[model samples]
Target: MRYFILFLCCFFSYSLQAQAPHGAIRGIWVTAQDSVLDSKTNIQKAVENCKKAGINNIYVSTWNRGRTLYPSAIMMERFGVAIDPRFGKRDPLKELVEAAHAEKIKVHAWFEYGFASAQGDSGAYLLKKYPYYAAIGPDGKGIEKNGLTWMNAFHPLVQNFVKSLVLEVVKRYDLDGIQGDNRLTAAPSLAGYDAYTLAEYKKEHGRLAPPINHLDSNWIQWRAHRLNKFGKDLYQSVKAAKPNVLVSMAPNVYPSSLQEYLQDWPSWLREGYVDYVVVQLYSYKLDEYEKILKETIQQVGSKKGQLYAGVLIGLEDGYRAKPELLKGMLELNQKYDLPGELFFYHAALPKSGKMLKR
Candidate 1:
């Protein structure tokens, strides 16, 4: 009886260790939009909560709503304030890095807004400063969708401007890595019809840009190719400036992300542009979530720990995911052989119950 009990303990321990290998990227995202980062005490409590939840990485927001969370020289020179006014002169990014590092957690500056100008600035500071830089749709209006305004990715000046924002963070902060998502390095498939982008396209292809039909296959591929080139350039730039700093991307699911947002992340991984790719598989149903997990495994083959799952813990719309759902998602990751995951936001973590311990 004693030998059987000992064997069972050893077997379970071995299984647990095998399921969770060393150096797995167990991360969670903390956005500036969260009120918890508004002060030093709140930020410390947030970091401590994550540490207690066994989070080892944090992807904090550096850019959002046409402002920066840190003291950005670029924004100060171009716009007015160096940091987001909601933060009240507090360097939340710096505080987050210090707090996370003290807890031995990795920090990545998530350029959440990337090339985006604003959601609806309505003649606000940034829009007033660079009105010409915003992207245009086929309707001859500013490219606005879901209330978000994006910058033209094909424009040389816009590309340089976005790069400067990212480089500023890398150079100014003691970060382990930098990241971009659907909003940063991407434009809507219906975008690129701006006067400048069209002129540039005509100059290269000897024709005006296509019409507003986003389903046009050739047009979609052409725009995606341009973004792909930008991705490669941005990747190289990040590495060139800081060779050891990791460059990561968390884009939406593939093919669909390409069709809608022109984010061909699998190709970026293949082209060696990203050090890590966190695929957003936010699903409410277990079967649907498991299906995406399988697809992620097939897509990220042989990369082995380079791809992490972006789990949706809670959303801003007051949607709190059940604890059982969260646990099942983690189990699916283990079954599919993925190493780790990053919850959408730290505030989504359960209040009292233990979650993600192993």
Candidate 2:
């Protein structure tokens, strides 16, 4: 029986490797901030726009700003609320999945705001229900950076709750993959001073946690390692529930991602935890963007097939790249032999729906 199970596993792995997209895995991210997801008409239009632009995959945001975009039994069970009221009973994810699948585009559930419970929204459901789970900072209060408040990434309760949220969707939805962005698996380096993490750290290391020095190399790696363990568990859990569903991550570029956000993505790839990785290489200057892309290529090395370049064609901050600039970025991706590219957003694509000429 064990040998039979091994054979099955080997066959599945081989099938995945064989089925990977031979051409670029052209993709786009649809974020909650766009609000286009609130209507079925908008979802259909969005999928059609992506199809016209040659996007083969859509990483739709499933969780954000303390609420889910889809009908979530897990959210309802935990918080007494299922979908974001703004959605008004509309399952945007389901709508997108159906539309995109009909168009032959794969859909991945993007958990954009993974551990983040709130962003300047004090009365968030998770925050109001379990305030104790919020991560504490050096100020000895719930840590809030750049208007975002994160749950204790190291707290067992937080990990279990968030994992359940992720797995819930995996079990309930026919998704092509599940994704974790920068904020999901990585926390601000200033966090983990919370009581739960400190106590847990002491138990493991036999000493109190370090003072709030964001640049503390040892301290940064320690917290990142904890998140890495979470990454491994998340990948395993998703695979266990749906062996064919891909596990993807789009983290900030390395070293900075490690020092500032405590994201150890390179290590995660080395450990074979995630099936796909898209390093966020958003730069306004083409030269700077290429430099980052070059470094990212070097970092991923032989694991090139598993990594993609996450280009920033547009941002909510009102920054949008010109068509020529976007084309240049795609050329660079092809130049480096990278598997594919994922735009930062769907709305960023030109309304004309024309594919960028290579």
Candidate 3:
């Protein structure tokens, strides 16, 4: 009788452990450039694909490049462009939300470009209309990095504009959540040299000019603090608009995220600015990916329950994540007992789902 009781206890424990990952978040991001949103039919098909793959959530890119996927009065009022011309009159966000909800899958409006005004346009569309909104570099030109042009993330005008965009969506859509990735409350560390930021810095720091070296520790902290405040405000605003709308962030791994982009997500997590975070741990190697995952787990510590690992499944350049590597990463996630994972994109769902099913 004693041995039988012990076996029962062990079996239940194993059963609980096995069921954990299934209950955890299984999410995928649907981007604007992907074919999944090209038509309403595609949106329905994508949601069906998600259901078959056991995905419970979808982060649809509502904002990207210099326009919105949905028709936006704000965009039209500000830039004379209501929606991405690529889709004609189709409202991708509305269609996607409807389709996903029909399948009982949660949808989050993802602001993919964040404060980025344009990509490879020399700030043509929105920036041309409001040039002062552009984040200025040390050379007195618009801040352009990695083919993306940015707005002044520290400026109140920029903050208000982004807040308006988020609130608009929250009020209009029946969304499960709203998400901001690496670019939302983040600015290139080399930024903050813009006239507005410089003046604000001077007012706070005894009228001293910002150090020429952008990498100065104090400078970085100050910029990061401003971003933290923006994050807090954004969170509060979203909650006020709809208390149930989850505020999610998908920033890059910490310390490096702080050093490169003024994204101090650790502080955001600590202060309750985000409901959860999916730290981007994309790597091609299993060992390196595991090492990073372990380090991230340690950093989050007691807050691991509010963390989700962001996995890169594939890129547009035909770089599909190997099934073995993906299986290994999922195993690592299981070993660490992570709460969930959010795949980088939707295009690789078939491959990823096959591995997940196995």
Top-scoring candidate (lDDT)? 3
lDDT of 1 by residue, 38-118 (tens): 889988888888888888888988888888888888878877688877777678888888998999989999998887777
Q: How close to the true structure is residue 134 of candidate 1, measured as C-alpha lDDT? A: 73
* Ordering by lDDT: 3, 2, 1
For candidate 3, report its TM-score.
0.93
Two-way lDDT contest, 2 vs 3, winner: 3
Off by over 4 Å in 2: 1-23, 355-357
Cα shift from native, residue 43, model 3 (Å): 0.7
**How large an RMSD does model 1 have?**
4.7
Candidate 3 lDDT (Cα, whole model)?
Answer: 0.88
Flag the better candidate by TM-score, 1 or 3: 3
Residues 108-188, model 3: lDDT tens digits:
999999999888862367887787888987777778878898999998998999999999999999999999999998999
Candidate 2 clash pair list: none
Q: Write down the TM-score of every candidate.
A: 0.90, 0.91, 0.93
Give per-residue CA lDDT, model 2, range 1-358, as digits (tens). 9999999999977765654433458888989889669799988888878877888999998888888888888888888889888888778888888999999999999999988888887326686688778887787877777788888888888899889989988998889998998887978888888777888778877686675775678878888999999889989998999998998899999888898789989888788998879899999888898999999878876677788889888888878887777778888888877768888887777642474434
lDDT of 3 at 297: 82
